[model samples]
Target: MDRYIPPVGRWKLARRTQQMTHSALRELLKVAERPDMISFAGGLPSPDALPLARVAEVTQRILHAEAIGALQYGPSEGYMPLREAIAERFTRNGSPVRASQVLITTGSQQALDLVARVLIDQGSRVLVETPTYLGAVQAFSQYEPSFEQLASDADGLIPELLSPAQLHDVRLLYTQPNFQNPTGRRLPLDRRRQLAQLALETGLLVLEDDPYGDLVYEGGPLPPIHSMAPDAVVYLGSFSKILAPGLRVGYLVAPEALMIKLVQAKQASDLHTAGLTQRIAHQLFTEGFLEPHLHALRARYREQCKVMLTSLGLHMPLGVTWTRPEGGMFLWVTLPPQLNALDLFDAAMQAGVAFVPGAAFYAVEPRHNTLRLSFTTSTPEQIRRGIETLGRLVTARLSGLS
Candidate 1:
């Protein structure tokens, strides 16, 4: 008989791409389940904002009436009614997208992965903001692309930092233009136009991920970059933030040429987003239920944001800087250069609070001094208590070290 030996460890048998691993955010999800933990680690939408009762009602209606359509295999592009709804939204917002240009994805996360599959190849040069959405970075990493970090400020990406030579080889530029994750920085309208112009002039593709656009707490709305350079940008939007994450409905608006490729990639990935979910999303929209719901959500989130900002102002240690976003789930915090966020994470946890270290958001070597705090999931009281605890921990750490 052959020696009793396993063929190989799954990790060893896995493709080199598997070595990349999932995001730190996913890892934090495990910690978030601890009832004792006050987590600012995940970009979770508030449970109060989710239209749970509305979803249950619509879901029952769909099963009772259109069960066949809801359960049967659907088109890979998306459910037709859902696509039309998404297109109408874009048009109403002034982007004027066609339903044919939309491809429904399992989630905006899936949209990111599909774009990576279709556009990124080995050694493809991709440009990203220094501190960007970690999920996008992880999704694009599997393609083995070479990432170049773009410098950014509170106003968003620095267009001047983009060089002509860099543009020549860049396969894509990825940005979270509206209330960017981690940073909570919105790109100014002028910078958005400049980014569009650069992409158009250089023939570079832009992946504009705007999941947080609709969650604005207190700012004037700005047009999407795709609206300015429709031909050159691939825009990703999601119902996860405004509607509900459980539906997992998101969409990509791409040029017709690119849309075809993405649809094929999406088919290979998961066929299409669930028809039942799409139908439910359509029902919610068609019945005119989301507008007032969104208004309520904005009000609640704005209150939470204010709580966190006020707490930070009162408790944050000296030599720290943070962004005050007009609308969005998160705020980026930069600690003294001598401090490492990763090392401080445990201390914060011990103090009954948790947040994501900002280093994981970078594709290159990370900044050890930065961290991200989200205000959406926690209660206003929790935000205040958590920040106070975090401040105490920081003060203790600095005092002990000094």
Candidate 2:
């Protein structure tokens, strides 16, 4: 046994591998699975929302009629029919996207990786919201770009705060304008316009990630920044939210010049998205299953959001505040400055309630007195119970401070 030990250190991993860290949300997902735990940790869609029967039908039909295509190696740019379907949907949503401009990737996460690889150099200045999506930070970090946090508030990132000085040397600005993760803040219409204008003026390439755009609960869809500045923005879309995450199908639209490079990067990465999944996703789009499914998802999630809001209002101690998002799976909770969310995690876990601490969402300086609550997966009763438990812990902390 002793002789069997290999020279592990001699293997010599890449520098980027050293920089890669496990996602905090993914780590917390283990706690979320405990039978006794009421988890608001992962941004997971409800099991009820998954169109299982429909998916089965689509999969069977594709295998029967197009088995060869489904099983064979697909184009790196993706199945042309699926790409065209996504492009048409984007065009209907106010952004005029073309199939030629779309490049299908394994997932939106891969799209993020490709964008980072193409645009970022070592020490390139990349701008992000004050507390941005942790996944974006993780993806972009591997490229060794310098991250700069933009000023933000409850409404979301402020276009007004992006001064000329801040714009200097900024290679990319990543934003999730609609129903953003962690905070669940939708950038307002005016802010979207201003941001689009700023990107155009500064020649900044904006990566607009809009996986949750179709989850609107309270209002009509606002024009995407990509629509406002098509040339300056790269848009990422996914079926993971509206369809199913397991399919791992997502697409990105960029300027033709940029699309060429992205397609090359994708080819090197995975060749193409899974062929069977691409065929299944295309049917889900063209066979008329997506629209009604979105309606049902909106209604269900809207109700879940309401219940969580009510629970927070009823149970949270004074000085604890949370965002009331119009649409999205998650919301941000800011605890009293004296109480750190990270410090509260173990106790909350012990009490069978789980939520992600907010500091993980930040790209630069993190605010310790905050956390994120995902409302889409848990039931109304579970939400109330978990929030009550969390509230009690927070009260005890506040009492200790007093």
**TM-score per candidate, in order?**
0.96, 0.97
Which regions of candidate 1 fall more than 4 Å away from where they truly are? 1-7, 10-14
Assess the local accuracy of residue 8 in candidate 1 as a C-alpha lDDT between 0 and 100: 65
Candidate lDDT (C-alpha), each: 0.89, 0.91
Candidate 1 global CA lDDT score: 0.89
Residue-by-residue lDDT tens digits, candidate 1, 108-218: 999999999898887899999989899998888878899989988888889878877879978899999999997999999888999999998999999999998988877
RMSD of 1: 3.3
lDDT of 2: 0.91
lDDT at position 309, candidate 1: 93
After TM-score superposition, the amount by which residue 319's alpha carbon in candidate 2 deviates from its true location, in angstroms, is 0.4
Clashing pairs in 2: none
The superposed Cα distance between candidate 1 and the true structure at residue 279, in angstroms, equals: 0.5
